[model samples]
Target: MSQAVTLWIPGLLDALRVKEAQASLKDLKLPALQTLLAKADKFAVKPQSFYEQASFLFHQPGCLPIAVTKASAELDEFNPNHFWLSVDPVQMIPDRDTLVLVPGKALQITEQESKALLQKFNAHFAEDKVELIWASSQHWYLSIVQPVDIQTTDIEKLAYQSVNAFYPKGNAAQYWRQLLNETQMLFYTHPVNEARREQGWPEINSVWVWGEGKIEADKLLIRTDASIHSNHAYLQGMANLTQSHYCAEPESYQAWLNQIAGFSDPGNGEIDKHFICLDSVADKLDNLQLDEWLTLLQQLEENWFAPLLQALKRDEIDSLLLDLGQEYRAHLKPSHLNRFWRFKKPLNSL
Candidate 1:
């Protein structure tokens, strides 16, 4: 048994951030939530950075920490088998519940057997935490049991502890292999729309529970190009956090830009935009000499991002410009960057 393992636990309630459009949540208390996020900065996203209720997860006695997330949220009507998998120890695992961690399980175990198995484990060691881990159920028989290494970091090494009855193996390896091949093929220049991609029954992507020992997803491959521009608050926050937390000797925000700017989309891409909360980088913005921000944006458009994308990616990080309104644009030069919109709120003295 391993002694120490680093399980990714969603932070406590005070750490997460939750955000919504002001009008969408008029009845809700936002200041208190923002205060909570201000302290933790717990969870983040690509388009925005905010916390989620999942941050306060506390697993029950026997439940496993696993979740089924849809491959794409836009898809209508979720079929159990169409989704991706993520491990969230605090939320996924409930006490007395067993978590089966597999990529795409196709088989569903019988209810009676599943219940019996649950009773069996809970009868003696109900207080202990365990997992039924596997890659794919190709060559194995039905059902499995084993002691788990809670301290294991590498998921592959922490295989199942006990083995149950074996069954006739299927062409699962071939199936998974084909799935991976198809996924890559679908994303090329001539992308296939989801409606036309199905060959079988559901005609949709779905997640499933196999009878133990099944691989869930194919390898994930998304490349961040060498040169690009624009702002994605989530990515920005992640990059900032990475620099602050991982890099021993700290570097400037500009340096982060210079380095990440080297990567851009290989395909022709459009300019992306994002915003950073003023408070997060307040100190850094105080010192400005000779329009340094504009200088960086222009450089990125010409030599850095444009060439890489075979098009261009423009970024607008002018938080100052955001508040200045149209008055600044009137006297400014033609190239003063007029891409902005402002909305003023009325007094809240109701």
Candidate 2:
């Protein structure tokens, strides 16, 4: 099987805009990228949200990353049949028109704080068979005994946006709404919030439920001899369920490239597909840190883009696939390098 590598870069388009505005990349010679673009076999140029794109890669049909019932079970050897939902602790700020939920990472919740909150939630909802699990400060899970045919929004979609716009929508919407209301009340005076407030930290005033689903293995698309690596909790959980080797994302592609002296196969020799998710750019862009975003782009060009191009020229890898989580993707083959006459559009323009 020919080897393929996928890099999911969020906010890549916006960064391209920055490059264009400043003509910062005017002199940037990314021969591999230019050749890849010129030789792209399939390219989708429309705009799409990162969540939608990444979800397609890791999630099964109707399954979301936040719903870790199966993945958690796969990794922990627990039961997979259950309703799993991502119930993130967030701080809601009331805007003139609506309340906006702060991003979970920005909330800076601690493991101790999340555990405390989970304890309270489990006890409060014990009779309802709703249990909360703490994965980390920013990643939390909720397991329910029965399934709710509810369509919930991904918190990523709600971050900095009006909560009402993406509120629960389904037959069980009211049930979820009531649960959310009760959850807010349960957390309002909790000591955890009190302490965080005292420390000038954002209080965990509310819990947003999204990525709700029952684990369904049939939804995941998997390839034989392919290993998926990512830091995303949901992706990790899904990888567990899919029996894919899951590892932390390397600091940069170069760090990983340096370790692979000769790419015979990824460790096991059975794996040919290496998927690395670099999300720092997406995070910086989401937080509106333009300076940080630009810096990361430069770092990637040097460490990732440049080296990968050289490797491709040497036939170290057969193909490179970039799933930008936007509507567009770049699928490049080594032969695409010969199309020197193709108009070279700025990376962002594509």
- Model 1's alpha-carbon lDDT is 0.23
Maximum-lDDT candidate: 2
Q: Given candidate 1, what's the lDDT at residue 5?
A: 8
Model 2 TM-score is: 0.83
Model 1 per-residue lDDT tens digits across residues 26-138: 33332322221222212232221121111111111221222222111212332333222322111011124442323212223233423333333234333433222222221
- Each model's TM-score? 0.20, 0.83
The per-prediction tally of clashing pairs is: 48, 1
Tens-digit lDDT track of model 2 for 30-49? 55555566666666655444
Cα error, candidate 1, residue 86 (Å):
5.4
RMSD of 1: 22.3
